[model samples]
Target chain A: MTINSVPSSKVRVRIGHLYGDLLNLYADRGNILVLTRRCEWRNIAVEVVSIGVGDRIGSGEFDILFMGGGQDGDQQFLEDDLFRVKADGLRGAVHDGVPVLAVCGSYQLLGHYYDPGTGPRLAGLGIFDMHTVHPGLSVRRCIGDVVVDWIGAPVGGPSSVVGFENHGGRTYIGSGARAFGRVVSGNGNNGEDGTEGVVQANAIGTYLHGSLLPKNPHLADHLIGMALARQTGSAKLEPLDDHLEWQAHQTILDRRASHVAPVGGRVKGSGGSAR
Target chain B: MRSRRLRTGFAVAMGQIAGWVSRAVGRGGGTALPGLVVDYLDPSALAHLARQLPGGVVMVTGTNGKTTTSHLIRAMLEAAGWAPIHNASGSNLSRGVLATLLRHASFTGALRVPENAIGVFETDEAAVPRVLRDTRARVLVVTNLFRDQLDRYGEVNAIAQQWRDAISALPGSHDLRLVLNADDPTVSALDGGSATTIRFGIGDPDVGRDAPDHASDANFCPVCGGRMRYIRVTYGHLGDFVCDNGHARPTPAIVATDIQADGWEGTAFTLKTPRGERRVSLPVPGLYNVYNALAGVASSEALGCDLEPIASAIGTFRGAFGRFERFTIDGRRLVMVLAKNPVGMNEALRTVVGRGGSGHHVLVALNDFDADGRDVSWIWDADFEILVGQVSCLTISGHRADDLAVRLKYAGVIGSIPSSGTVTVLGGLADALDGAVSGAPVGGTVVAMVTYTAMLELRSLLVRRGHARAYWDDAGVNSPEVTAR
Candidate 1:
């Protein structure tokens, strides 16, 4: 089948990194870097504008909106900014079918609310139909290397994406939302559900942040292609050699598999357990 | 007390046997294993062993520089004619301290050293409370606190709370002296109500940066919720900072002034303490080491050591192993630097790129083991972008080579490499080391920036290759052939 193509016209893909400085707890800026480099490699023009607290973005300013995780203290400070300054702009961007990737803390903030178990419930942007809550007093954070089978992409995405997830909030997808993937290993969203992340409209929210992109080139390319398609009406991105990227992704998968306990075997205890 | 001493003696004997058996079986140093066995046999082994030191115990705990600072203090004390026992194996855990103490103890559970022999220990940040609960420490030297190992220790504030609780619970008669980093707001705020606190910092404004880096932590004032305005940010959130509410960095009792950081050659500075001013030419690179040296000076002075010998000892002190140790192999130079966090990694990268010569090679090894903090995402926070167009070649290695390779690629380092082969990713450390060494031009240096466990692994590989001595076998600071540059 001949793939539909459009003439390359130096398409400018703008990305607005919300809370680029404050909410970068897990190197989430790497995701923005990955997006920018992947586009530059294809001769596509890319621009990234950092939108921190009190910073505003125009409705049509960016093709992709990226948000990363931050410390609990930072999240508490950013909650007011997200609602006051960025909620409308980001909501319009998502409504325009612009691709959004929010990880960890920002992922929780994209939902309706985030209840951190002890403090006042934080208001979210209500972009994705979901809510996150702390796993209560007795439960620890759901953290480790995670592997998931991709389920939200239309076509040509990878069968699986591997990354690391470290978060205390367990998100539950609401009735209007859909899960981005099926959890293959490690806790996702919550340990109870075999689901990881939320996919609503063109926005995706996840806890996976081994930077979330460099290892999963397909997902990175998918978001890039979606951004380009939105810009140029229709486009097919030329693929770069991802041999090393696949190697890295497969390595994480293998590591996760090895770390997972065998069926009915002894559970691996948390770190700091004396031998 | 007699029965308890007898039990401790029996435990020490068993621990020694265990250490011998483990070493004979080629299972590495087995330092912590002996302590574990001892603790299992006698729960009071650490307390009993710690009580034998006539000079009392000194505890050093912080997020970074704990090992190096404790080592420097130990060296200063030794130079002053005091035999100091320390956990020199880079093992700062409770069991590691117990094992070191047991090694110095006689078979009768009595310290075998001289009467004035002291005990200096580097305790893990999270393990400080537990260590203080057992031993009667006379001095507690907290270097600084940053957000590290979030998966292991919840958050910076949580760890600070733990430390506060630990300090509050100290006995009324303990008379503890606290040596803290005045620049680090989180660490400086950890002053216990009754303890005598001595603050140390860098007073040289010339060495400070114009602004804080992206990964700088504790940017807000601890006293007020106002944003902190830094007058001079040496590195990260360290240096002189003030808040709108009039809260400012504490006046450090011991400060390094007139700083001259000569890159890899060494840093020469004049230390101004309450006692007097002494010029200290520390044979180490990076401002972090300067801070570590200042911490050592303040800590030693707090313990009543003379200023001249302490400054002289710090001047000659080479850094702790893997902190930044230089070695020459096959006409190529290897500088091993430990980069466990973003702040540390950025400093290492700055030191490397600041070398200013071409044909420089960097091999970054990352591991997600418990020791190295299972989350490897902090690599993104490190400013590897500085090396994008700078280095001639780059190699990514270790268990998480791909993750690092991806980070480097996104940082624009890989794309800037003139050739594809220059940005190679080798999974095995042995192969990566061999490739990096051979790949380097003759006389060119290969900076091996590695994490904690990876540093250990790389050092072992070097030891096997006859490149360096085993850390356990190396003598103290005055060991011959151990030079500054």
Candidate 2:
């Protein structure tokens, strides 16, 4: 990969951060930082517009969409606004091939519904053919460093991505759906299957939330290229040195390979059982 | 009662034996082992031991500044001529409390202490309810609550609810006195019942930041789930706030005004209470320490101490171990500051950057050990960008040194290009310390910001090098020579 100093034309990219204030858990803003800085380094202008409750998403308003996880009750607080107000806009955007990246809780909300194994089932946007089920309060959360091989990627793109995962909902994709990757280590989506995330059109849904982008620059650029291809006329992106990023990514992979699972593993108990 | 005393005596003996064996084998400080053994032999050992104190227990709990605030309160109590038993080593679990009590107890399960002996303990956020149930502490001082160790303690709101339930469930005759931070909305609302609440806040508007911090864990109102409006924000969500649902900040009874924070020298502020006003000069840096000082004054006053001596004690207090400690190795000054979570790390960076001169040498060590939360994602949430133009040398260490280096790169402190000798990543703590200290001039200072376990390891390394004494052996603030920087 060569770093191009000059491009044929000036390109400006717009990003829509859904519920940026409410749904940002585990320092999810690092994804935004990675995307903006990578583009800036390539001399591409980027604008991030945070879309909160009762906010409207116009057509072609964004080239890429991102949503992150939140606290357990925070999802409940924003559920009505997400489903009633922004579901159709999100569905329309995904249909238009706008590259979307949704993390843990937001990924669960993008599915058909999330049954928390309690009183009510939270309705999702139905963007993907999947649904999540929390086994019960007795089951331990899938919290640990996760490594996944990027199975469905463009040729010569990122081979694998590494991040940290902390989620309780076990998401199962439908038979017709395709997976984003295969989990090489750590529990992903569920502990039973080797599947990690789901892929729908140009959208990606995963539970990896070490912000999921600073360490995996290749995956970030892959999303940027897709968004550029759909929104702009050209998809050409200049590559920069990712030495530190790759080192951070390989550090987790090396640690995972060298020892037993870092911290989180499958066990029984409630949320406060760590005490 | 006779049988119960005999059972307690047996548990105490067994716990002491275990602790002795643990120390003989060079395991740990044997902080939590004795408590675990006692809990197994006699489940109610904590309550039985805690009840023996003539002057009851005083607890300090919050997400941040628990250790420092408890240390300040203990100093204030000692200044008023009372010997207080404290968990000074910073082992703050329920078991750690039991261990402290066991260390103060006789082999026959009897507490041996001075006639004016009291108890002061800093407890973990999740273990508050358990500690309360055991000690029945008469005075509880809450500094502030921030989102910390989500992997271990779950969520901030869940912990708040647990604290409220615990407070409300106390016996009617317990007469609990609640000392809270009025600037923190979540902590201010913890006093819902009939307990006498002494609220403390920063009244100086000059210290407020122009823009809110990145970590706003308490932006939502604690009373109702509505978005809160901050009239003034001191730091990270600590400010005067109001919700549209009629919930507003209470008028703090104890307030700090006319603040002046000198980077490492210390922070001075006017401590105002109903009794009178006194100017307190704290030997600690940052606005968060101002809050810690006010909490110490409010808590000790609740324990029947005069405001004059309390202010003097806070004025001369050095600091808790690893919160901010100084050492001299070959004439190079090493300042160790503990940065556990995002908010704390932000304040630590702000203090370092606010120091007078440029070319600041900083060694940041981040670990993912059990003590330091396994998920190191919170580093991204901290504002290391403040070091962009200030840091002349940056060294990253600990188990997650690569992650910290990457974070500093994205924060613009480290360039995107290859190594330029400005940023170095060394995984070994001792090597990183040596590199950072030697990279600076002999007369210059090197600031070391580290996580919980990393600070412990670094302090141990310093002790081994004969730079400082062991933390558990540290005498109180009465001896000015020990803490003289």
Candidate 3:
């Protein structure tokens, strides 16, 4: 239940994509837009921004942070910039409960270090107790439904079959760290079964893409509600209508419906993300 | 004698059964079984089933021109009166091809394969050595190489080198026949003295593509690692070429001559070879297609198919599935062109844009995937500079609409970028097509240059809408030869 405070305002979220750096996952931006749009419907002014290198990042200045996937070269080029900008204070801000949604490369960056090294070994800001290692290019393509057991606040519960995943980074949790969620059919965390994603405090990261928000807006609403809750110290959010998002979700259902199976009535292994 | 790959009444019979099953059990995936069947079947059992015929195997490969060129060669073989077992469905992978072979093997395991039928396969560029080692194809058609699938295949140069090493490493005992595209310096290197090689290309400088179409992948010599020199570039990086080093140079065993490309009217070229020059006019409308047809004819001849019928058949041949498939959408005659890579897209765009069809509507579907190559930076290289306000209406769709729109905006193209610039980054396939078609005035032609997966989606959508027919049903058993106009 989203508990809204009396003095609630529209929260805007911006995805600072260096345009073509990461954000390769089609589902990544959808997550952000869906998040903002859902918040707007909730009578909250959620302004999502496309921040870049020079953008400002101060504590208590924003509600949520998002970064998406990219190729190895993209990750390499942004290494120095991300290392300098997204470190320490910002990591701490995110750690102290500024809801951040990291997907793929960005998810790797949130870890202690990204190993098997894409180019140079990428060291994270130690925001999350995880180290992502490249398993030398295995086709870790995940299609069909992605179910996430939400570990964060507001939506602190189990959610099943969200979307798809295609990544090479084997996110192995460190000694003390725990998994974000379960993956029904993907190597979400170190090739474990039911690998959905991970959540530490207010931060949630996963490989599910295409702005996973619009198709699976429940997750988006959950994330936004959480972010707004963090910003206002209130878990309550006003109601909103989402026919367009429902239509988008219906599109996925229609596509899967065309390729339904006999045993489970599911369409498995059919997605366009070939990373 | 070769044995039949598809048993009699297998496809037709199985088609009914599958249809019934789909109706009964709802529906199922079209491509999932290829990999599943291959993974489940024993390798020896599969290999044994593959060789149940005397025709053996012949594989064709390259980055671009593989589909059109191989299809041409297959038709020519059949026209020259040869039974050829092929994966004409254009599923060019081990699993896909394996499933194709499964349809033909016999119940007794004694393959009733086509006696005169020769197994003509278009293998994936990276998967060639594996397919070759397995089938030991007697003849291999090596088309040009280019930069593609950077996320998976890596650099173009790396793939070319891998191709050379793979071909060269093959056992000398096998009569490894090779058909090389001399215009492409990277592929011509496969003609190393060890293998029996036959080079095919074009010589008509007048009708050749004015310059690089921007998406040319292979722009260097693979042998000496030196910059390659080009006498003429037909499209992208493909053209008549020679390396500064003596190691790689164009051979004149086969050449496309007397070329004539009438914008959208059609393209026709003469295949000039050691035997003689025979002009064939193809319905395909681009000089790039002339090279494809010539390569197909040349490859067919290398496999002992007569050049006369092959040439004649190509002259009358219609368009491939989507290279130039035409149909009526919203009462307008629209021509569809499949454009996956930058080179392919540029050539298709040039064909239409040159015809002053900018006044006409154009729809583009760009998908950046492992299938379409993750590194879509190549869009910067595509000659979309030609697309402009002259185009009355333009619609762009696919996975990365914003990315593609950004590329177009950067190109200063005055047409729709599918984002903000007079474009609609449609959320659905049907909506995109409807948006594109609806924007064009009645009777206005809509030309769509779509990527591979997009092509399939668009085709399926169009077919479902009753606006188009399955391509195989249109082309018939053997599409006519495209003769030089």
Candidate 4:
């Protein structure tokens, strides 16, 4: 669909990709690209503003805020900027119910604190009532194909979401926050509880960083709907053809199933091995 | 010593038998079986066999271009009257290297082909330390390091630390000559002070990118916490850079000046060495390959090879298999480029689009198999968005075809063209190859950009279809059939 086809009266979804360049370690830019393209395919205008380190982001300037994972060094470079420069703006946006999706490193930073096991614990923005700990160097990272049964999903959203997750931190969801989903396969959160990700109001914090959206079109559309609803006061998203997307989603599920041996109840490829 | 030599002979004989058995079973080339047998029989088999070479061994290791650079060095060594034993099958692991050495050595652990033959083996970055600990290589060439296979190798810094440790531990009397990439900050900083280090880099300012790429790593000065200022960034973080703390790019002993890179026809550069300057033409394209050629040239120069013959050999050198290797299938030209990580994939995409222009048929096969690095997340780091609206027909194939198709669609590549191009996703490599070949216009080029294992699968399919020769049988990219295409 052409950009001009959308009526001027229709509200456009504005996305502020926080630390788009630096914190984009898992190809997390694909999330933003998918969100924009899905919106555009539905004849909805989408504007993406990259909010980098030391860049000032205005309150309520965007309908949605996206932050992806980053390397340890890169996260260290942005820790001060997150707390000093963009904390207030981000807090205000979240207070205004602007949908926020933070994955892995950004998810850890959205919590109360993140202990990287080497340096002093990094203070997070405290947007979510959760904290993450990197359980020493001896501990292996939680990585592989992750399938989660999404709880409290938006209307018309899928019951499950599939994505690849690679993270070392073990997040513990505390009071004032709810689990976003239940782990169907693979490690979620601390690998102890079945919980995966944090859900507090409209903000999402998860370690699922296969960009976490391209394979899960339903989730992408739901986030877009939430952001558009916050701005336009009503969410009426027209359904676009998602054949290829569902095909991708199912392929991951099939891959996960094939990796699990039914008889012994043992996980073959579910662990954090690189295959 | 006699007993140990007898044990080595037994190990070598077992390895040869195992290699023969594997090949007889039609399991393709016995690249690693023999090495496994030898390692099992005697852990020190490789080191023992390597000591038999009078000319010693040369090790090439880096994140990229290791295979091509090692092949180029082998070509130059052959031209200079040295029959070099090399692992030319794109196998850089320890097992592969051992197998290559065992293939050329007799049961007595002596050079079978030529008494004066040397060894040139491309080693994996993680395998470098183990290889170094086992053998005293005469020359070590490090192409460059980038963020690659995070799941397999933790990070670039970790690998760099490993290299530093390995380099420092080498015996001083061994006189290991290090050929380093002067442009790569991580590589250039690896002057361990114990070895004679020679640096090679691109000196042409015109070849630099307008700015550093979005995914550029190593931008921060390793010496200081301050940021690095780049005068020019050729691709990613490789270029001239200096830090506020007085840390700067090293002056390369071997440099390429006035580089003229034609994506298809190949790259031509004025090679400036410590001996003299000469014009060198590389059959393979990309600035990365230019760096590879410089690494080869510097390593050859350190070996006391005549610069004239080395330059002449490089001028006629084609690339390794699946490294921009071309073939004609069903009257359709197909150039296969192997891209396993972001930087390599970006370069391959640039080479394809730059040469083929708009409306080109492009096949991208992404596999997450073991050899290809199961983490497909790096594909997102590559700038595939550049192909949006550029190609007429794009086919995504492999075990992870759906993932790549989703990525391409999100990049707006599927529907970006005015007359929206066809974007097909096939599950099988053979099917994808057939689709791309049949759909491509006659006489037009179809660039197949594949991952490590995907390239093998595609090449095997082509061989079965009588389009391309088996990788082992094919001489090199400069083979008569390949060059004629």
Candidate 5:
């Protein structure tokens, strides 16, 4: 499925979205499709099992863990489910180290609880030191292009990246934690910074839902490499053909370029050829 | 007034002259721009000129099921034997409102109606507060709110807060009754400081959940910050529940109980309230229509309409334009379920599911341009998850056919035919509508989900073919084929 390179191994990503169905989960599921298909386009086989209400996911069972924004009831339903499923245990598996990407609700659930004192103080997987507040406004909606600088990467190149940022929850960047990037255009931390996206180790979480990978293929490659690296004792997922996926990624790239003109306005690359 | 109307005939000639000029200038030629042009024209010109000659206005707005709710409210008042002036066409804009008034007004700008009637109109979500300012509506009804058109209407919470502010500014003693959706915490919060705060919802606890639907709104009470609990959810964050901070929870006064689906084609329910529990039937399918009916009953009650007429009119309710209207386009019978947003599409799909088998083709036109969310990301949120293989052979089109096709694929349905081109999308709507009635192995069941702006395009097309008619004058007789569903 890789568009510009050799085919990579298949991976199954189960999108636990049913909670969204009940707890108002729309944004999360959108990220899953965008990410899963973006991975598939790189010729990476992604078997997506959208687990709704009463559905369960196993650790190492998923190459990447994902969640979306939902109403407090969404978190309400998962209060115990995350504990029973050991969201922490799953994240522990990620730290041991499986790459986990939780966004909005998933990100919020990765650590601490919401509606802290008054509302139901449900537990998250505690993967991060993050705590969120409910009854907050859906004020943070990042339109147009998103650019971020990556400080650390298993496979390094440029520090810059682009995507969409949309969410109401914000992380204060607690002890041992750090702000992913200063807002390039729209809101970030405290959400007034125009912060675009976030990343901590292999677990890259963002409020962006342009199928993050489609807009940032390098990260997709990095995560794929990291996942494969864990499974094969090698960092790179060899024999990768990303031709079709690169083209698919181009779908958003072409789309976004029209909206958020790239760094220098445009990157001149042959329509069908690789840079 | 009758004498004034006779004298106003001269001015009516002038307004008609304008209308005729616009028609001649192609403003009504059915172009995309023409509709926009008509809308851009100040509807206030008509509303302002008629303000002194008529009864005050009644404005209704919310995300889910507002059209059906507005229609039911209008009917209840009419049945109560009042000449309720209303826009039954489901057009909640200033243009539609002006057109409605123009149709009833005379030349010198005098309203022909007597003063004993009520003006029942459904205003758009963002347009309500502004429209309210223009007309002194004694009773302002606020149905529950959910996320809609994220691009245009910022946040659901923001809108709910705006509603609260708007209600607070209303004239002190006009009986500003707020009909709050019990399930939504964000909406109920606006109930404070109102002359009358009556809460209505699906009363059966068995129907609700501790959590909410994938697209529920207002999880916690906006005030007090306490966890807003739900006894049941009709859909989204709408249900019966209260907060610890004395914030408004689901008020049990006006309740909808025994909300059961009759073959899921539509709903039959017990309208339980302090007045009495009445068994009501809604021909419109989905749990949403149940809410729509309840909201209608509550508003009609506020206007002092008799309960029986409200119930009867709701029972006889055929449904708003494509909200769930059944029609025969080109000798083919079909049902048009307007699935506008993620929450809407989910409910629409749920209704289609209740109808039992898709047993018919489903045509979904997802317009993801500005009118539709520029971020088609919400389509993934649509409960298309409900109708995986149930309704086989889904034909997809619209501005973003690729996105919808991709969405259907993500939902695990394969081979979604992306309408080859833009014209094909329009063609697809007709083809799918026609396919519903084609009747082969599958029965006459074609469901189409279109966006708000697309509905204008869709309605005009349906009207030209005579498959659809304006719901106001179209109901009761001339369109039995429409209600045959």
Candidate 6:
């Protein structure tokens, strides 16, 4: 599916947001805003279409795809629709190299299955060669500010991205999948392997979602470049002034570096300094 | 048993000493540390002291509006001539409740409040079960539950289950009165408990949004696990909904209707109750405050207070500390609203826009402090786009100043330099406050929307400038003499 390049004109791009209603728990819509705004700032016309349950995904209809995390109950309710209706289409798009970004719950759902320790095993779309386990109710969730040195860094692009991670499930990636990045701080993936997410082809899955993209413009641009490549056959993107974005990203990293250790734990209401 | 009493006495004495030292050292105002000390020494100290209150205890818990609603309830109780001990500093955990009790307790670990004294405490959402276990509150007001601090409280569903379990586990003899929000499906479903449940909701369908907010969490029915559809949505997930499994919104015993909002001046509504209808006006702005007032009225009535007195007391109640708190400096007005989560921030922006008309000067201070829920991503989920065409000057500050800048920029609030007026990004709270206030024209209003800790910092700055009083010294919610300023 090739798109003809029109020189010196606005190139309209369509972004497909899967389950925009149900699967947006952790401010995940910000990632979509980042993509659209970056495209708009560069004069690349953008339109976002929300494809919810009982909807069909036509081939080559989207330049990029996004799915976000959701509460467990909401995720459970949508599993049937996700697998029965959209699984084959989603797999087809990934096979076709349509760039996709899945964060947190959606990342877990891209794997083989998720065993929540108590409920019945939930099947995933098996797009990524990994599986997640909740361990149990007694185990603490991996939550705190997280930093990752992205393994698939583009030339002259940001190599490190910072975001927040909050999840109970421990994900283990198999040989079929490549580690998305090396965890520089806080708990990542299983909190034991020092791995953060999984990367397979043009698709990426991660738990780092302080919306994960606005502050990390490099990752946003990388995904945007890949998405645009499907149409223009060129991954070159003109840079915008990212002064505020980089400052925000660096602030989290600087805070982590200054602290003796990462600020974590169930900080009681009355205790703990605000900063 | 005698040794246990002696241990409690020793704990009280030591805890008081610790509190004195904490206050003397310029720490907190001895709000929660003493309770922590008492809890460490004797776990049963809270239960023992709570039982001594002749008027029993009332606990209010929710994701948002806990402090404001709790304050309103405390003021209503005070107006009813009951000496109420409340956690006025907004320290809402079990320790904070224990500290409030400890303040009115004797050195021998006995309550020293008057014979008509009552306990009115706000509790953190996750700490509800533990707080319920200790206090066995005669009345538990469950305000609307929204997703708050996922890093701390986990998921909303998990917290809802925890609350259901806690309420169901209450013994039949305690006779706990459950004040549930009928518009909130998650809260309305919390009626499985044996407590006498009184539900309150908004009845004006005109106020509901045509579409559900992106921050809504209760899409699935809390009862039969079926998908739910909303007929009307006020804000966020609070609305009239029915599930595929026939579960529907409960008929509220108390409902608000014919709402009239006068910008920041406040909202006046007709409150409908079984006893009779009363016209109530709240100094706090927004529909969220209406929900808060409904909760306060329901809880007060459950405690045997009459509707007329409750309505009147609510009208006389001033805003909570840093919640719609107004201050006059130079020649401009600075109204502060605390917005720590998406739903709360959405309401805050709505109130600010509603009050200041079209060309409003707004300041948003965001902090990733532990108390402020370290993740700042929720700002994107909030509907700051409402201020897109309504704002003339926008100022952002605090720990995540640039983060908020990015969010507002995307929301189109920080538009092209010439069209949207001006945008200021500062790292310091005081500088941002000055920038926002000065940016407004003379006689114009500047609304400050801040997080928990940032609000604290801003309030302290105001105090230093002799514009406001320290929260601890201000008799805001407790003193009947203090009316809406």
The prediction achieving the highest DockQ against the true structure is: 2
Question: What docking tier does model 5 reach?
Answer: incorrect
Worst 10 residues of 5 chain B by lDDT: B476-485
Give each model a TM-score: 0.92, 0.95, 0.62, 0.91, 0.71, 0.95
Better of 4 and 5 by lDDT: 4
Indicate which candidate wins on lDDT. Answer: 6
> Which ranges in model 3 have alpha carbons more than 4 Å from their true place?
A1-275, B1-39, B207-216, B244-248, B368-370, B373-375, B415-422, B471-485
lDDT of 4 by residue, B1-485 (tens): 88877887898899989888877775757778888888888888878877777788899999999989999998888888787778787667788888888877678876565655788889988888878767788888999998777666755666787788888887878678889999988888887443478899999988877566666667567666456788888887899999878899988899999998776779999999988999988999888999999999999988988889889988899788899988998888999999999999888888877775588899999988767776788877788988976888888998889888878877768877556567788988888888888988789889899999999989888888888777766533112111110
For model 3, what is the alpha-carbon lDDT of residue A9? 47
- List the DockQ of the predictions in order: 0.36, 0.50, 0.04, 0.33, 0.13, 0.47
DockQ winner between 3 and 6, please give it.
6
Per-residue lDDT of model 6, residues B1-485, tens digit only: 88888888889888888777876775667778989999999999998888888889999998988988998998888777777888888888888898778777777887877778888899988788888888889999999889777777777887888888888787878778899999999999888743479999999977978667888888889988888899999888998899998999988989999999988878999999988998888887889989999999899889888777788987888878899999997899999999999999998887776665587788999997788887788998999888888877888899889899989888878773346478889999988898888888888788899999999999989998999987866733223222221
How displaced is residue B235 in candidate 6, in Å? 1.4
Fnat of each candidate: 0.49, 0.55, 0.00, 0.36, 0.17, 0.61
Candidate 4, residue B364: CA error in Å? 1.5
RMSD, each candidate, Å? 4.9, 3.7, 10.3, 4.4, 9.7, 3.8
**Per-residue accuracy of model 5 over B200-270 as CA lDDT, tens digit each:** 76777666456566555665667765556665565767766666666656454677777777753578888
Error of 5 at B461 (Å): 3.0
Q: What would the per-residue lDDT of candidate 1 be over residues B122-145, giving only the tens digit for each residue?
A: 999877987787878888999888
- Please state the error at residue A268 of candidate 5 in Å: 37
How does residue A185 of candidate 1 score in lDDT? Answer: 86
